[model samples]
Target: MTMQLAIEVDRADDPRLQAYTSIREKDLTSGHGARFIIEGKVTLETALRRGRFKLGSLFLAKSRLEPLADLLAQVPQDVPIYVAPQDVMDAVAGFPMHRGVLACGIKGDIPSPAEFLSQGIRAAAPSTLLMLSDLSNHDNVGACFRNAAAFGADAVLMDAQCCDPLYRKAIRVSSGASLWLPYAHGGTGMDMVNAAKAEGYEVWAMTPRAGARMLGTLRIPEKLAILLGAEGPGLPDALISAARPVRIPMSSGFDSVNVATAGAITLAHVFGQRT
Candidate 1:
């Protein structure tokens, strides 16, 4: 029999519970997987049934444990399954209530840029690549990938300064698309530009400058890399100077769109032209 440890609901107010929550976030940023704090029974059971996410451990209210007995059977016997009083689970998590279950899962490895690029070519018809330059926000990075996937972009390339796409917040914000999308990191923005050129891609930098062709007016090449930069700084002058700078047509008052949003619009335009 699995040893069932019961914790009181009020115990969530204890320092230990607070510590556990803090540690989980820290672990996620450090590329370590932390146990997920699942609320509803349905979500927990569904995740287990899917079998894609590795469940490390589970926590449940004693009353809810029996209802989840069959689900528990699906998990490995050695995985710790704790029973805490409903109130305790709620207090510890700083929530009003938990629908009765939580689980921990192992962190998966992030694929190399080379591996992602190869996979993109194999999977997509005509590869569309989005290269990000020094964008630091994980949310923006993840949103970019999500939009890329949605807009038919084949792969994403990140300069070294971009946030880790696999970071927990990024993954969650991306609605988990970050896991499925092919992406590369560690390469400098320029290195990516060179690689894309070598792969027979025409690099286009999205920038706001005089004499730059409007996005709608320019003819995008069939094989292309759309280069984007951080919000305030935009692309490096050298990069913009080196590649073709294209501007999206915006309303008179608007200065610029969010980089991710701009990426989506450009991707739509380019991919639309291809098909």
Candidate 2:
């Protein structure tokens, strides 16, 4: 690693460190900015390996320097690395800063959801898509990404009402899966369903409503999109009505599972069929 490429900062309010401040508040309103923070060593490493998102800079505690030396060597020379003492790091981040590693990623030239889907589908023959609707919880959104990746889904499509999958906690909760997963967010759930159908995908909206077909009974399609919604409210009736409704079998008293868990079960089933 080029040790000199790292800059040592002692001030919490340093202008260069502005992006790492008030993380919680910023995560909520950040939108799809050109820059976003990636926390922890694993997420940073995943971001580096994926190379889909450009890395702007790295912020690390001095203690983390020696441990991450090998990984840091892979960073582009143009990107600056900022090192600070743990106390100063905590002060700057307005939190414990326990992970001791952070990176600013650049979301350059984001494509429209349709474009993303088309490109991903072309790259994978038996494509699978994980779709989310009105999922406000960051944990659930992140878990969904992790499940999608684990099950070999080609990409994810999120409705405009869903929370940002790139949010810091979401990234962490996903165990860095969000760093590599190709996903598009915005537009209504119906828009995504229609787009997938147009692309020759058989859309399956997961629901526990009465009369929905059992997931095990259906055959996996060459191109499939599994739509999952937030818990409690679940998917909108109109949206569910628009696609093939599928449900996981539950005991007599239970009808549904956590949205992410439900996604995992459905995606796993799809993966099993492919194998």
Best-performing candidate as measured by TM-score? 2
- TM per model? 0.69, 0.95
Quote model 2's TM-score. Answer: 0.95
Q: Write the per-residue lDDT of candidate 1 for residues 105-150, one digit (tens) a residue.
A: 5545544454455444644446688889999887888789878878
Each model's total of backbone clashes: 4, 0
User: Which model scores highest in lDDT?
Assistant: 2
Can you list the residue pairs that collide in candidate 1?
A: 9-87, 9-88, 12-92, 35-104
Cand. 1 TM to true fold: 0.69
The 10 consecutive residues of candidate 1 with the worst lDDT sum are 30-39
Clashing pairs in 2: none
> How well is each residue in 1-275 modelled by candidate 2, as lDDT tens digits?
46546899999999999888877678767664777789998899898787478888899999999889889988888889999999999998888988999898887665546666666554657889999999999999999999999999988888878887888889989988888878888888888888888888898989998799998999889999999988889988888988999989999988978999999999999999999
Superposing every Cα of model 1 onto the true structure, what RMSD results? 5.5
